[model samples]
Target: MSVRVLLVDDNPVVRIGLRSLLELDDRMDVCGEASSGQEAVAVASRERPDVVLLDVRMPGSGGLDVLPALTQLSRVLMLTYSDEPAVVSEALRGGATGYLVHGAFQSDELAMAIIDTAEGRPRLSPAAASVLLQGFHGGGTAVAEAPATHDRAEPTVVPEVVKQHALSRREVEICRLLVAGMSNGDIARRLFIEEKTVKNHLNRIFAKLGAANRAEAIATCLGTRRGA
Candidate 1:
């Protein structure tokens, strides 16, 4: 399936460059473009792109400020040059599907990020995750910067930590499997992904739960204190 993208950045040159690169990939399409936050929202409401690639810093009402509005229409991926942890944390809290550093990323990276965002996957770049993890662990200037998830009926399948860490739906699924005592290989087989991917999810899960290891993670998710 082709992913429809709404490119939102103040710079026309950047939008043109991004459109050029995105067109190189056959699975994605640039459906629209916007140069400001309000314009982005209006375009998104009309075009309803599967993913919105938004700049973090834009003139007049920054991208993060418009995030919630756009999210109501489609998933959003933050595209920015700022590597500041605080900025990354704020973007995540505003409900970004992923955060990408424009310069550090390549064409393929952007393509995959779009694909993942369209598929309801959280594409936290390693750099972004490092900063977010610090926030989760009280190291950030604003501690526990958990992202605000979209409004939906709270499912019975969701765990308590859902509100606190904004774990991806896949992450919550993996957490359920962990509670069932599934090993990494077992999770990989069940999820039909590589064990390496499961490991990566576990790392994110543990960090979000502020767990030192599996036991703590499970305990934390269940809202129980460790037996030790």
Candidate 2:
């Protein structure tokens, strides 16, 4: 079955371009389009799409304002121009399944992101990943000042905040790998555990950390949240 997607952006040209790009993929079906946050919610509630491609800045209620509602309706992947660490962190905290900065991904990558998000996997573009890693490293800067690659070196020791969360040793190991940008499959292979086992650990980790998603969990662990 084709993955139903809702395009939410204030720009008509952007929506049309995205629709045209996504239509090239046989696995995607553009279910609806909305030019504002409120309209996006109304259309998504009606269409019940598998995934929502959301823009951060809109006229009335921006993407952040309506993010919580949109997330409850469907998996949301932020497709925006902003790559600020704070904005990325907030969007993740708001329950976005993935973050992709505009101009940082190709059409094929966008299609893959929609599919992955619908399948419950978080996708981060290189720029977004850079922001998260910079936040993880306590670097107060934008993506332009950070490295362009997601191959940053993993921390040698887990942060004390993670210990405060009382995560088990294995869970700590998983969190370390996650901060290093390893996916569940990659972490599973690296730790010699099943992917399902990794996910189970992550669930417990998130619960303990009071995190809504992996990004939030990492932010909490590293104490990288902007106003925390």
Candidate 3:
């Protein structure tokens, strides 16, 4: 079955371009188009798309303004030009399933992202990931934070949930970095390992935690920490 997608952007050209790009993939169907947040909500309600590609800015009622409603209808991916950490954080907090900045991904990647989001695996472009990481390091976002303690140098203790999954030490370390919003490449470099190694570890981590993706794994760890 083709994945139903709703395209919401103010620019007609952008909408057309997106439609063209997505149509190339046999797995995607552009179910509807909306030029503003209000129209997006109305169209989404009627079409019941599986995924919504929403722009951050429009003439009125920007993506964020209508996000809560849209998210209720379908999984939303913020496809916009803005990579501002604040905007990214706001969108994620507003229930966006994924965030992809324009120019950060190609058509194929976009198609894959839609599929991933539809399958409940959140996708983030490199720029979006960096923005999230920045917000996390600045201590102003939902990305996991080290437990509050007197010593700033104290290592982030792995959440009990992670341990319950019986993750290896290296897997726990990768999980910690992932919750911090670090990309696979960043985690690989941070741990002085090849990117492929990080991918392998992540696959193992996901299997152990029963997580579908990075976001789910992070959410599991963070939920445990927040409740502690």
lDDT top scorer: 2
- TM-score for each of the candidates: 0.59, 0.59, 0.60
Kindly report which residue pairs in candidate 2 clash with one another.
none
lDDT string for model 2 (1-228, tens) is: 999999999999999999999898899999999999999999999999999999987777778879999988999999998665556766776778889988888767888888999988888977667656654321112333433233556653346666677878888888877776665655777889876688789899889888887678778767885432
Give the range of the ten consecutive residues with the poorest summed lDDT in model 2.
136-145
Runs of candidate 3 with Cα error greater than 4 angstroms are 134-228
Per-residue alpha-carbon lDDT of candidate 3 for residues 1-228, written as tens digits (9 for 90 to 100): 999999999999999999998998899999999999999999999999999999986765778889999988999988998665546776776788889988888777999999988987778877667755654322122556432221233235356775678777887788777766565655667789977688889888888777876657777766653322
**Would you list the clashing residue pairs of candidate 3?**
none
TM-score of 3: 0.60
| TM-score winner, 2 or 3 | 3
Task: Report residue 215 deviation for candidate 1 (angstroms).
Answer: 38
Tens-digit lDDT string for candidate 1 (1-228): 799999999999999999999998999899999999999999999999999999976766668779889888999888877555546776776678788886777677889988988887777666687866765431122354343321222223345578777889898988877765555655677789977788889999988888887767766666674531
Q: Which residue runs does candidate 1 get wrong by more than 4 Å?
A: 136-228
* Model 2 clashes, total count: 0
Q: State the local distance difference test value for candidate 2.
A: 0.79
